[model samples]
Target: MSVDTATKPHDRLAEALAEDMGRVNTMIRERMASEHAPRIPEVTAHLVEAGGKRLRPMLTLGAARMCGYDGPYHVHLAATVEFIHTATLLHDDVVDESQQRRERPTANLLWDNTSSVLVGDYLFARSFQLMTETGSIRVLRILSNAAATIAEGEVLQLTAARDLATTEETYLKIVRGKTAALFSAAMEVGGVIAGQDDARVQAMFDYGDALGIAFQMVDDILDYAGSDATGKNIGDDFRERKLTLPVIKAVAKADAEERAFWQRTIEKGKQDDGDLGTALALLDKHAAIDATRAEAVAWADRAKAALAGLPDHPIRGMLIDLADYVVARLR
Candidate 1:
């Protein structure tokens, strides 16, 4: 996608890091290419070419550059982050049995589950190879641990996501695994590559962690009341029977009859006509969307705050504004 001249922080960040992003994109393309297995590149390009902000990997580049690293390995790390993200997306589409992604047919729909899963594994392996090129033991440890955490988060969601008994604590753990784990890892590894002190690296991790939480919270709220874009299509989560924070809060405040409603729609997966509308009404009645939005804002604020203890580069200001822009979707 063309970068808009509009002053969106991400777009501006892209403009600022255009040269580095070019290198990262080149690395991604080169690494995704398989010399023998043509299918690998096809599947990888389908998703990679799909339009996304590349925000997570950009965060890695941003972190490294802000810390004054001019090495070529940042490109490798950024590619590693993108490959990991793409791998998870492939697996997630299979798990969700999704028909569409980024407004196109999902790989699972076009190919098969076996293809999607194996291609995702190939990407994961590619990510590890890219990470090794960095040659920092700490970088290896941080990313490897993040990969484990990300897988763990997905498994926990498998069991806990449908269980109405899932608490805020459990939801938080799941978010850290599936979403924030990568974000945090991306940032931490960026700092590590720059050889920043432990304190700075920890702050980098905190920024990514908070930003990711806010990002997911906004997504959860969007599922309840979103469009095809900003908000998800209305009630996709309901149809999936996924117990996100909004519905979880609604369930918490449910009366006996409301409990039966949740049990029927969510726990039993016995949704009928008007069930989605009913879920929306319940969420509104409980002000769950409002509460979730508030929490998202809080996390976004925390993300901006984390940057305060670090660099004073213009990119740091962009990161702060990026946090605000994420939560601004709620507005």
Candidate 2:
């Protein structure tokens, strides 16, 4: 397959892995079904079909193919990764009380919190069933551990919310748990299934770990930068009083007056009119956005560097391009 320069890296990857992705999608649809409860399918279908980038599952398929895995289990694993991701999003909407996701009404909003939470639970069960089918205990262990880490991360974030005392290290720990764990597991499982050596598998894990951190950092940046394309309203994170990296960085450098502003708006949740603008101004004053972008670029670089140990395949180039595309928005 040939890709044009005009095509985005992920689009190029989708083109390259078209057949595998088709199988993964088919498996996702088939596995998301419910025999007894009709609402299960209904709630799951809403978010599953909401036109997400499917980046996590794509990482699974891309890694497996890059490692020359010809088995059908990669499809199963890809679907499993996506199911876990969708499940988290379902629960997240409920926790955040978010009405919208991927520019569509959230399952919690469209149905109710009960339906969304139950459906998310069902997906988690379904993901476990799918992983077990792979008959690779290693895959199951990796995914199960990732599932636990994701939950742990969410809990940590909950406790640290709007605290102002949340450190960059704490922020990184949250990022690794909530986002990077699955990414590393997804890629590592692919290499494991392909019987790759320990070193190569670790490299795949390293790539995904870095990529996930960069992805979340970019998301935090967009929440403040106001990207029409990302469907992120400027200051959504600010409105929620979430202590994302940019805000954390600014707080680190803030003086008494700036600290008081963050305390009132974020800690006290006493946001009033024009607070968003003031917050943006503070971020600019401290160059927080630039610092955040620098961190994202560094992670993207680490992601690309990790791929150096992988096989010389077309997928490798595509994966490298994907990492570059992830941080290109910040540039």
Candidate 3:
């Protein structure tokens, strides 16, 4: 047997659980099918087949297996996690009015907002159905709360994303809502299903929370300094007027002229040529990217530290490496 050096740590993790992942993928395809509407599969298949890392579901599987679960329910739980994540992406694209995702046209653009939103809703409903199959009220409660938290986070961002006065504290709250909630739920459910003790479950939640914050902060920095490898457009956050951590830090330290520049370009939406370049220069002037990267690394450290109490399985090492990998793009 041979391994591809190009295979990422997450990829290796997936390979380690190929049988479970295959079941998860199969379950997802089966569950996503709509009885009356062929369009549902078409729209979903576009994004589902877009080659996301499937990291969330893998986390669920890894957490469960690391705790010594051999039951059939982990597969259902993993599928539910993936479905929830996909539904969120569909809704996020529509909400952002985004045109591209994973380098392909977003479902909202290829179809319409109505389809995307409805499909997302359908998946959300389907996710609930899958979770119920496990008969774990604890898992249901956790995932449902995460779903609500994700929505709440998005709404918070609606008010806060464009406002220049958005503080880092507020920004972190938004991140916890839209992004970290699911990650936390994804990992926590694993421990719950594996019948782990409360302490271990809390550890799982802690790991996911820190890892997710690091993941999102890395994404914020990548928006300024990404290559094609990231599959995201550089400066997308700047162009979208979303006040990520880098911009938040820079705004917190801006002089009068720089404040005015941000106001005109972001608040007023009166962007001009070289505005992105000017934004980059301001970020450099303040070393906002470096500071933001440092924060992400700190979160990564927190995530790894949370794993110390977990079982000393190979999956634990992979999960820790995953924390490192999430922030590695900054380097």
Q: Pick by lDDT: which candidate is best?
A: 2
Candidate 1 lDDT over 140-217, as tens digits, reads 898889999999999998898568898988999999999999999998888889889989999899999999999999
Candidate RMSDs in order: 3.2, 3.4, 3.3
Order candidates by lDDT, high to low: 2, 3, 1
**Roughly what TM-score does model 3 have, to 2 decimal places?**
0.94
Model 2 alpha-carbon drift over 4 Å, by segment = 1-6, 98-111
What is the alpha-carbon lDDT of model 3 when measured against the actual structure?
0.88
Q: lDDT tens string, model 3, 257-331? A: 999999998887777878999999999999999999999999999999999876689889889988988897676
Query: lDDT of each model, Cα atoms only?
Result: 0.88, 0.91, 0.88
Off by over 4 Å in 3: 1-7, 98-111
Model 2 pairs whose backbones collide = none
The deviation in Å at residue 151 for candidate 2 is 0.2
| TM-score of model 2 vs. true structure | 0.94
lDDT, candidate 2, 1-331, per-residue tens: 2435557899889889899999999899999888899878888887899878889999999999999999999999999999999999989978887523433664446567778789999999999999999899999999999999999999999899879999999999999999999999999999999989999999999999999999999999999986656666788888777899999999999999999999999998888899999999999999999999999999999999999866589999999999999998665
lDDT of 1 at 179: 94
Lowest-scoring 10 consecutive residues by lDDT in candidate 1? 99-108
